[model samples]
Target: MPKQPYRFSYLLLTRLLLLWVSATFPAQAQSVYTQETALARDTVPSFKRHLPWLAAGAATVYVGGLVYLNHTWYEKEKTRFHWFNDSHEWKQLDKAGHFWGAFHESRLGADLLRKAGVSEKKAIWYGGALGFVLQTPIEYFDGRSPAYGASFTDIAANTAGSLAVIGQQLAWGELRVLPKYSFHRTPYAPLRPNVLGNGLSEEFLKDYNGHTYWLSVDLAKFLSPTSRFPKWLNPALGYGVEEMVFNDAAANRTLGLHAYRQYYLSVDLNWQAIHTRSKFLKSAFYVLSIFKFPAPALEYNGRQGWKMHGLYF
Candidate 1:
């Protein structure tokens, strides 16, 4: 079966909406901190008056987004609860996306909770599980849709993402290994606009061929604080796929298209590590940390063997 583009679109839209709601509070709260006090402020918890507003706003967006999604994406379909095994689709790139979305969402949830003066233990457990909590319902919706069925692997990926954040917070008290994402325009989207995308915005969500998932490690975090290693630089491994205009192997082969996975060796920027006193910059970096910064990359794929990009997003 061809993969449903709406699934990816729904994830992307929900992620963005949650991020916007989460980010707004921290950005506004930035006005109270000075450079000397910023680090100290983060470590201490004090219940803020705005936490109620934050909770209300997030809840509103969560419910509102679901209502909108059901109306726009699921209303026309005849649906009944069912399970789907899409573990093989899109070379598991969609699973990578699920992991990325859940990781960042969990990270945001924890950060927001911490900022709102929630206890450390509560924040770690609750906020760290936020991504899974948010994404699992969409699977329920999928289960009922004739076009898409609930995927066990998708739930597993979401769980892994949340666990990645939860485990790090419990052990290291901060994230050292980050899951990130990057994208570029691809010609393949025009080949099937309905499934891939029709425009830049839709393409970004639906076109798996243009998407790359990265795992970036902060080397400085492991080294001595006195070490001279650049705090902002990280070594990253990336995974991507190309030539997959159709999710079905037979469908792709009929058109002489073959899908192959690509691996990348690249460097990334740890935006949060960069020193900045500005509250807006701090908030911006926190949000932007989910993206892999453009840099020279070495890529290897079965078809191409090895190739170098001047810069790869």
Candidate 2:
């Protein structure tokens, strides 16, 4: 099986967190009524009383998941600490991915904490830290692995991702720029299954050749409130790569292909901007907000020609 790192850690944690929040919702319902009526919330549900158990359970799951990741990702052989400068690979595209993942995880964790009644400052800080916590454990194991070692660049990128969210929120009290991603099948992916991945599920994570990460900045938020910028529209800047079957330039020469950086200017829909009376629709949009809405784009590559995308995200 091909390696699919980074995907499992966050997806699992988010699901567990959602479950945890859902389970605690009933207990918090009384507080909602109290706030509406200006009355004190005097009764605590039995479930809330046992929340320590839920916390313990969450800890157990996290530990188990980390252990499993270490066992599965690291070989039995012992290896010394080492480092990799993956900044060379994919024309620094993977770094964009690191930032992308870290940003979402940090933001989601913070939002989830807020929903759980954590203080805003604590939620943002803890959520930002959680991104590093989730990502760094793999590095400890990586440092010991002969096949893969800890990369300071990755850690830096992860911190950037987390702090990017924290900084934005602390400054403006809302996210003006959001990290988003989109992908399309590429010929390069099938050529190196062991590294790039063999299937759709694996390829999405491992195939840097196919992934495009974006920073979707809300134009409406940036402009003066009275400006004519559409509130629902976001102008996105994107980073990606082309023809990167190998990590280094020399290897790519053998295939008669040059790996180059691709830059994109695109438009995306800010789904969260949509206002609606239906709670279900709002929740659904929120759930799907992680994805950038597909729209037309124009791209410029490093010494590659200018190109147009009729539908891009």
Candidate 3:
């Protein structure tokens, strides 16, 4: 089966819009701080002023995005509501993209709420669920399209991503494990430009072979406060897929291509840990935090026993 092009484009647009909104608005002054300080900051009258504007902006984007998608994409192939089982598609690489997208969206929602003077408990619960709220509705749009249908697995991945943010906030009062993404151009795209993508920008979202989802662990967080370990350094595990010109195994095999999974062990940078008082730099770091930094990596795949990269993106 071929992949849905609109699905990839929709995800890419949604993420970019959300990132823009997050960067345009001011985030909480500090990324790492005590629970008490967080609560106290919410009491500031000035912070409450942003709540209405933020709410309005978010609502506008939500409705506007759906309208645009409906006209541009869904209208081309309207259908009765249906279900799609894409659990096995793209070697589950698409699922990883969903997880990564939802996680960052949820994180941004929570942080934006905190900045708007919402209480810690409310922000943690309501804001943490924002990613699920934002992404799930698109499944309805998908269900109505003949080219695609509502995917249960996609919903599950979205839910898990939201829970990840909520769980960390409730347990550790901060994010210790961060979901990040990295991409590199691949020759596979040329084989199926219409499906994989035609250019760098499109391939960034549509090319599963180029995508790598990572879980970056903040090791310094577990150490004592006085420990000299670099707080900005982290260890990360990554997952990717390769040699897939088509979603179906048989189709790819007919073309002499075999899909294989890739696992990676690498180092990442904790951009949030770098102390900075500049609001612009802080926002930049918050947006950049969603990506895994390129570093030396060890990789393993069933097709190729083991491999190493001096610097893997």
Task: Report lDDT per candidate.
Answer: 0.83, 0.69, 0.84
Model 1 lDDT on a 0 to 1 scale:
0.83
Residue 51 deviation, candidate 2, in Å? 7.4
RMSD of 3: 2.3
The TM-score, computed over Cα atoms with residue i paired to residue i, of candidate 2 is 0.82
Which regions of candidate 1 are displaced past 4 Å? 27-47
How much lDDT does candidate 2 score? 0.69
In the range 128-195, model 1's lDDT, one tens digit per residue, is: 89889888888888887897789999999999999999998888878899999999999999999999
> Least accurate stretch of 10 residues (summed lDDT) in model 3?
29-38
Candidate 3 achieves a global lDDT of 0.84
Cα miss at 271, model 3 (Å)?
0.6
Clashing residue pairs in candidate 1, if any? none
Q: Please give the RMSD to the true structure for each candidate, in Å.
A: 3.2, 4.9, 2.3
Predicted candidate 3 versus true structure: per-residue lDDT over 113-158, tens digit per residue: 8766667778778888988988888899888978778999999999
TM, every model: 0.92, 0.82, 0.93
Model 2 agreement with the true structure over 133-214: per-residue lDDT tens digits: 6666666776777766677877898899899988987887778898888877788877877777778876776788788888
Task: State residue 210's C-alpha deviation in candidate 1, in Å.
Answer: 0.7
Q: Per model, how many backbone clashes are there? A: 0, 0, 0
Q: Residue 290 in model 3: shift from native, Å?
A: 0.4
